[model samples]
Target: IQLRAMIRWGLETVHRSLAPWCSVDSIARHLVEQTESLLLQLSDVRPLAPNKSALNHLLATAGWLTPPLVDGLQALGWLIDERGLAGTAATDGLAWCLPMHELFERWVEHLVRLWAYPFGGHVRSGRTFETLVPIRWSSAAPKSLKSLVPDVVVELGSQTWVFDAKYKNHFEELDDQAWFELAEEIQSEHRHDMHQALAYAATCPASQIITVLVYPMRLPVWERLTARGRSVTVAEVLGGDRSVQVALAGVPIQLSHPEQTNQIVAAWNPLFSVGQ
Candidate 1:
């Protein structure tokens, strides 16, 4: 009932506000028309305002039965997060948007963990609250600062590396446009990413600290960059008394062959640890 209502609400909102704009876009028109048709097939399913309590009850009741059910419940939960089409204006006045970074973050963690398995040190993830380092706040500070959490931390002996997965087009942008020629917003955002990565590095108390910003890119691009020794760009970030290397790396997605994956891991051996 709630699912049907959510769908109905979405269709209604789009039809009322977006119909004029969607008419000229072939793909958008098809999706809108398709949703209308599917809603017709689900006529027996009554429309109801999405209820959080009921949805939780349903998920807990059947989520344990099957994997598909769990996925469906998760998708439904994302749809009903406080970011509903029914915000402050009306019951049907917004669009559903989902961020893709969390999935990318998880994939980064998996890849790094898998490749660095031979190093023999524990892996910690920011998602699991395993890499949190509390911050000491001074009195009279309008304190929003709390702690520094790195996306992935690998500690091999006295050497530590913090890898922060950024789902950015920096690889592509840098390829197409010169650094200074890029848009102001892009440069600003990149600076922020760098700042966050530096903060993450502070969480480690190792003699040698390497902080890396890992971005996903096409396998072909990764290969091209590797040929030029630009796949992993590393430079000394801090001088004198402190040793810190800041690196921006391009990591390709998981490939088909085990040997191919191993090849990639071998290339990353220097950054993480010696190969097994």
Candidate 2:
């Protein structure tokens, strides 16, 4: 398997060719070019045209880890419509697409870990196999759910924060609405998120648990919510000894200012304090 060469070439190709498809026009041109200089030294490895056939071949032969690397290429806009690989009508050849939920999870994990370090605790993530809990299925079927992995986990003394990042607009559409005001579909999905958070809390052993259901919010909207003291909604659940706190919060995804993200994360201190 030429997996090593393939991944290096793919990264360089993305930095060189498809970078424009996803580059933000608002960023300074010089800075963007400077970022390109940070690419891995791939002088000997020739560029690979990330076609579906080639990526598929690698996936079929390159053991288990090839999928994520191939996926990174797709995220970089190299897998455009029928031109590169077969895709649904969403691409439209001109538009760039990515699994925003996955991206949001990584962003949240990074931000949370930065703040978590001050607590003198270990930070873990599903991305690194740090928080993956194996499921014991009595009679496993073909392609059953493998593990219950919390997006981000932080351990602090007897308390733990299990964050589940969801990149949904449900807060804008469903938050503050009456139960009857929400559509059946939105209601169902919101409940599903809450249920999943509960499952994570149950699986993870902690005397005091904070199960955070985080969603993506625009910078302006997050600011508005913060002003009203509603950015982080804290609901104390499981009253007695095993105290569980269910937090419904939104994180600013497209951050405009540096302190804006810091402010959003700082609001979480109150929830962290609850466990202490």
Candidate 3:
């Protein structure tokens, strides 16, 4: 229900902005036409065997496609073309529309603020909250790192958290070789995340540096990693429900629904208060 309402609101908002130049119905019709055309073009080409010309055409049509959105759409297209779209995995894979997903997430947060208990008697938004807040690691770095900008960064508060968002299908099980390879890959990535977060925390002495791995909840096991006194926590969040399964130091909690996230924020408030 909330998702549908958000989609409608997004369409309405777009229509309103363009209303002065065109009628709402006309604007909507044009959007539909464009989307259908794009889908048709996309349908003809398999991403694995994508022809350069076809990719160019699709790209030209999707002018508003941001990097993350492009990544998401390509990921979805791959999943659909390879795996028949008829299961929990497919449903979860289709839920990656980038900024649209982000909008829905924020909406959930808004609903939580209105209906749920406050995280710390004050719901943090914008740059006020530790996780949402941005920090500059190198004083001389060309630009201040922004969360919206999208790159690996450690969020510092009472504890230092290294955070990254993985938008991929979850694994149910793996054989021994696959398990070893997977573990090695994750360990390397986790170490890199830790180094970056630790670098950020060096500037802020009071904070304890921690690392977190955030992946779709379908993946099993949330393990803890410790190297040289730094801690890394791995958590699995449900892709469909967006419910957070684990919370760890050195990681920002990314939830599927805002209401559920608000509950998480409320839970974290006490820890924050005591740590502060």
Clashes of each: 0, 0, 9
- How far does residue 155 in candidate 3 sit from its true spot (Å)? 9.2
Residue lDDT tens for model 3, 59-165:
56878878975654454344334432222233343453556435433433443344223332323343234444355477677765564322233333444333333
The number of the candidate with the highest TM-score is 2
> Runs in model 3 with CA error above 4 Å?
1-182, 205-213, 219-259, 266-276
lDDT of 2 by residue, 52-145 (tens): 6666665567665556665664543443333332222333433556687787888888778767867787899889889999887777556577
In the range 1-276, model 1's lDDT, one tens digit per residue, is 556675565455445443543533344566678767866876776655456676678777863547765554444454555333322234332345546788778767866776668767578899998998899888888788788888999888777889898999887687778999999999999999888887877667887888888888888888777777777777778565657888888877645443465556556766863221
- Please report the TM-score between candidate 3 and the true structure: 0.30
Query: Which candidate number has the best lDDT?
Result: 2
- Estimate candidate 1's RMSD in Å: 14.0
Write the candidate numbers in order of decreasing lDDT. 2, 1, 3
In angstroms, give how far residue 253 of model 1 lies from its true place.
Answer: 3.3
